[model samples]
Target: MKVVFFGRTSNGKSSVINAMLCDKVLPSGIGHTTNCFLRVEGTDGNESFLLTEGSEERKSIKTVNQLAHALHQDELLDAGSLVCVMWPKAKCALLRDDLVLVDSPGIDVTTELDSWIDKFCLDADVFVLVANSESTLMQTEKFFFHKVNERLSSPNIFILNNRWDASASEPEYMEEVRRQHMDRCSSFLVDELGVVDRAQASDRIFFVSAKEVLQARIQKAQGMPEAGGALAEGFQARMFEFQNFERRFEECISQSAVKTKFEQHTVRAKQISEALRLIMDSVHVATQEQRIHCMETREDRQDRMEFIDKQLDLLSMDCKAKIKKITEEVERQVSNAMAEEIRRLYVLVYKNELHRHIEEGLGRNMSERCSAGITNALQNTQTEMNEGLKPLLPAPVREQVDKLVPRQCFSLSYDLACDKLCSDFQEDIGFHFSMGWTMLVNRFLGPKNTRRALMGYNDQVPRPLALTPVSTSMPPFPQGSMTQEELMVSMVTGLASLTSRTSMGIIVVGGVIWKAVGWRLIALSVGMYGLMYVYERLTWTTKAKERAFKRQFVEYASEKLQLIVSYTGSNCSHQVQQELAGSFAGLCQQVDVTRQNLEEEISDMNNKIELLDTLQSKAKLLRNKAGWLDSELNMFTQQYLHQGR
Candidate 1:
């Protein structure tokens, strides 16, 4: 805490601080002695040093006279500059208790009163106005505190009527002068400033001779007797009054420092703790609510997961059964359609155009008709199966499942190469005795028998071959077929086999015919064979050979279609099942991710709640401690006041 002294020039402001320290720590003279602000504070060790403003250099001051000389020489510094004097705490009781005394330049000598107050007086606990007893309070002195009052709230002020010892020369007017000084000072503080009441203002005002007090204290410190002098009249009374003033000043400074500095800190600390506790309580409530919300969401997700799991189980079983039933229905429809298409195969093969190969034309026509029939049957089955499975998917996943299975369950590219099937029919109407033994053997064995020998055939009819009439179970849908990978493999394998067969046939026929006949014989054989082919062509339309060719082609087509019936139906069913399962799994994965996020949020909220709990406890303890300190300070003030009384 700091106590700052302010007054006009030659009013003993420095002498007052010196008397308070019981030493001439500051320079005092007949005129302005303190040119700059001097701050005297206590230090721990016995070392006393002077530090000039804006300089770190320490000047040791051991003797009182040396201290005075040092301050006098410091007159070169501006009045606004500050110099700090560090004296041992053991030299003064007030300084030992953390009191600092600031001796400022006389207010009358400086126009920067506002600057001075802002620089030094803002933090000062008590302000001492050392006025001369020979005069009324100067306007300069009052204006300084007016500026201070403007900055601080109800600043603590004490008015000292210094040089009161001169009143001894006029003992006749002593009481009158004292009463007048007291009334005017009290009126200025209570009426003009409104800082205190009349009674408190009277207590804050004092009339004492700082020079007398300083001389007496110096004599006492040196253990010397009171100096005998003619101006010693009323010396004892003046000393007593000075001692009384010291006691009041000490009590006032102590209580003022506590109220201004320590009490303010205590009150602020209490407010901060209360505010923190309230904030922590609010956070704790919010966190608890959030945790509850997270838990509820997690539970809802768990229930959803359970429902989805049940739905998946039911969907799996229902889909399997539906697919099996659909497959059987598709197989029956395709078989009937195929049988009809095979019966009409003769229409394509028996054409007399001969512009292109008969085998190729028949193969192309048969593939188109049979593929269309099978595609229609499979498409109808797909539409029915998709309609059946639509209700099985949960509402949340229905749109995604539709996108996955878009048009149909699978693709059907039924490329029936009729040449491979119908090539068994041989043109045997012409005489073959001149041809060769090979021709004779081929005719006796017959085209059907020869076909069986060249290409393997399973004549055993497929089971469950009975054709059921098409049912209007569901509306027809657009056809889809095998995946690209499966289709590519099938096409590639078929082309490779056909290429190998063509190459081998070319090589065998060219090599054997060339070896069998010379060039002239080959030409003669070709001429005779052409004449016979024309004759055979006319007989190719005979009823017997037509029936035989048609019957053989039908048998081959029917057998191949039977195999396709089972494969196409079962493959489409499996594809539908896979599409449904994949969509369902994706939906389940999304639900699991949401549930995991909720769990993490709940855990974070729990940790935050715990942290808030700890903070609240700490704030509570801090608030309690501040309250205890405030109470203790109040108790100490009351006891100190009682003792003074």
Candidate 2:
């Protein structure tokens, strides 16, 4: 695995490489500069070469003037391919692993006629394109994106905002510059994706003054060589600043994912809990005999109805309260945690630092172009609704609203927005609770065993009643077949038809009791009152039958109600799970895609940077040679003129 950078000419690729290496190997400059591919191989001891024509050649130091023609022709590269060369100083660094660094001639310098930057980019696992902060996301950069993207899927791309400090006064101030650059960088990303919000062409992007890191690294190395006092503190500060940026970014992403998952789970758990509670409340009031056993007249029935109604009201209220509590708990636990994390990140991580990270890590040309194009396209999308309408009725006579803005109202007003928002929330908040509460009501409301307690089912057997089971030979009810109503009716009928022999004994007793007139009169009065009491009790008994019938109807209705609520809630849960899954999956995919894009942007930026370095190195060598030649020419001309005189 290695990092290769490529981009438009003079995008500070040289400065990026030099900074990365903590050395001044490549001079950052403009124009036809790079002479050959300078391969920075990490250990692994893999031997390869840039053979002259066909034979193996030895690596040697050559002046820029000597390599000028091949640099222009790009001939040093054997048919323009990758050639590995080990970095002598970092030999120890390479022996452990393989992370080769390959630098190509600047895009502008690589054979003016034979262009193949896409090939270089395609070969790299991670392409890092470096662009200057001053002229980033230029038109030329856009072309580079088109070329490289044409070859392969850019999975791991990075963008390094090289020479980032050029835009600001101090290293501190560069953060703002990074933000501005990233905003433009984001545009390019939109362009590439062809979307308003999508992961651009890169995996990651970052804005760092590679120059600063390089300078800091160099200074630290110098400090190591020579004992320093204040330099140590400065070194510590730089390292801290760098690490802080990385930490904050990682923390933000981690916390965001946790918060999202937490909320999702909380909502689902509360729904299940509510369903269980609903089932419990409906079973508490029924008695062992499934009877109310009320010993009262018609007046009692009305009083009982009133009490039962209040009980229903209380149950309903309790269900509502329970739902509210669950919602509050979810909000308190999950939302609060998210808020606290956000606050912590804000205080510890600088906003500017985040922007810089984005710029450097995701500032690749392909990423920028993709993001920008997409954003522009979305923003440009415009169409008016085709439906035509006219008012149908006169406006309501208002006391206040009409005076403030008469004839300037629409249905989708601010008030409607508020209402709409509230309506949308009700579907979410009241969702499972409403179903569970209904199930509870259904389970209890009907005249089942529980309902008898409310409506008053009397378990009374009249004093004179005698049950006679006349089992017909043809057919007889099974043991538990007779309902309480059936048995009570049979007993009352038997008492009414009691034989004359049973009456003869009562008559004899009546005659004897009558002879003692005074005492008999007292007994007769008691008997007369008891007869009236029977009459009253019989009427109450008739009322109880009616109450029992009503309870039967209520029970049947409750059973149906129970079925409906249970079915509805169960169905709702299944559907909700499916919908939630779809929604969550889509969101997760979006996040992953966007993050990948940012990372790719970072890689591209890094690649482009290395290309710049190679160019600058070749150009600097030529520049020095030119100065030497010019000095020698001046000396020769002066001597010749003096001797002729």
Candidate 3:
């Protein structure tokens, strides 16, 4: 058993310990007396002291006074070190019971002394807080002991109200004062420090005059005033019977510290148990995380593939619907674009003023002009339509392909598919535009010299008509009509010769007719107005026919283009579905492989956790057994204390 004496400077902490040993083995004085921890234990008929420093050999000392001198002199020792005394004191009751007494330096003297107590003195089985009983527990006394209370268990601590001899002025008054001090200190422990039992509180508080105990022991050793003789008046009357306090202290020490060895054993075992618990908690958390990851991986492998497959089919249908709607929109855009271009051309032709020659020239080349204008207007519109259809293309196939294959391989597949779709769209547009244009000319222009403008055609005169495979193609044109180039040339010649022809014909016809009319000016003017009106009617008729032709072309082209675009869209949608399925399936297989690897790792961690659980169970059983042994030790010590009493 180990016992530590704790208190303020000059509080008689060393005096109490000296009295317990019945030997003045430690120094005590007014100012900063003992500054180092001194451990005093029993030895076999030999007295010695040793000073220990940091990692240096313990130096043996010849006398007890050397221990105090070395501390005061700061020689033969380092700061934060202590001395141990193995004295051959066979008469000491504590040494007989295997108890070692520790005299700590007065607390709160310096941070160094406090550090020494906190670091080295915490493991004592019993702590005796020795305060001078001249006054009740002071604020400093309560504070110092409160700190000690924090480090040690409450059951292992006791309060010693030392130097009770002063209150002997009136014995009855002194007794009442001692009771009040005991009660006040007991309440401080219960109310301030949460000590549970008041009875135990009162039992642990001892009021003893440590000064008187020291004096009595010294005088006895010197054999002054023979054994069993009455004492002389002054100093001898001051000898309070401190032996009762000593016996009570021995009793408390026996029951509280000596018998509770198993408690110390249990404390160590609990520390090890707590360390294992923390490690186990970490392992368990790790295992739980891995298990959750493994479960999610398995779920992804089983459920995600089926869900993606279903979504792919739904996506295909949605894309097909989107493609149909987009193509219809493209048809409308193309028709609107063609109409706008025709309106612009009409403005350009009419803005210069219409004439018979210019009207005829425009009519002759109207088919070629309409074809070129429509193609240019529709070029940008067609490109916009192609881009709009891109989102309708399925993403999963391209996305999976990119992930699983090299970039070059994915690029090859993507580019080839796009090129094929574009080529088909261009071919269909050309076929339909050519067929629509051919039908329009043969029906409205009386295509006597008509030929396909967009497709390759026989450019020679009197060429035979060629058959076309398109269902919308019209019958062959009649022969013997002016070609578009010939008509344009003839119309230009008519315009250039118009001024000379009009002057000559008017003179010849007007002279003969006016002679018949007796040279009447009014009659000749009326006939000229009539000829001019007929020429104006013919010019208006030509414009109406050109307007009719443009309307017919627009309607025909819009219908035929829609059919061709729809066919191209269906083929592209089917191809996209096939590519998507193969690539998506390959990706699912790779994910499954990763999940299997995780499952293997999770299994290994579970096995290790199982082994740790077994060890934890064994540790708990050993701790319980230690607690039971401690209970038996308490019972035995209590019976022995009662027998001694």
Which model scores highest in TM-score? 1
In each prediction, how many residue pairs overlap at the backbone (N, C-alpha, C within less than 3 A)? 6, 84, 0
Candidate 1 residue 299 Cα shift, in angstroms, is 5.4
Write model 3 residue lDDT over 249-324, tens digit each, in one string: 6776766653456446555555565555556555556555665665556565445445545654565455445444
Model 3 — which ten-residue stretch has the worst lDDT?
Answer: 407-416
lDDT of each: 0.68, 0.43, 0.56
> lDDT tens string, model 2, 172-283?
7556776777777666656672322346322245655655665666666677532233332234444444344334433433332233333334444444444433332222
Q: Flag regions of model 2 displaced more than 4 Å.
A: 23-32, 43-55, 61-83, 89-96, 109-118, 170-176, 193-203, 224-645
Error of 3 at 29 (Å): 4.3
Where is model 1 poorest over a 10-residue stretch in terms of lDDT? 353-362
Error of 3 at 434 (Å): 99
TM-score of every model? 0.63, 0.31, 0.40
Off by over 4 Å in 3: 29-32, 55-64, 75-80, 89-93, 112-117, 170-172, 222-241, 258-260, 267-645
Ranking by lDDT: 1, 3, 2
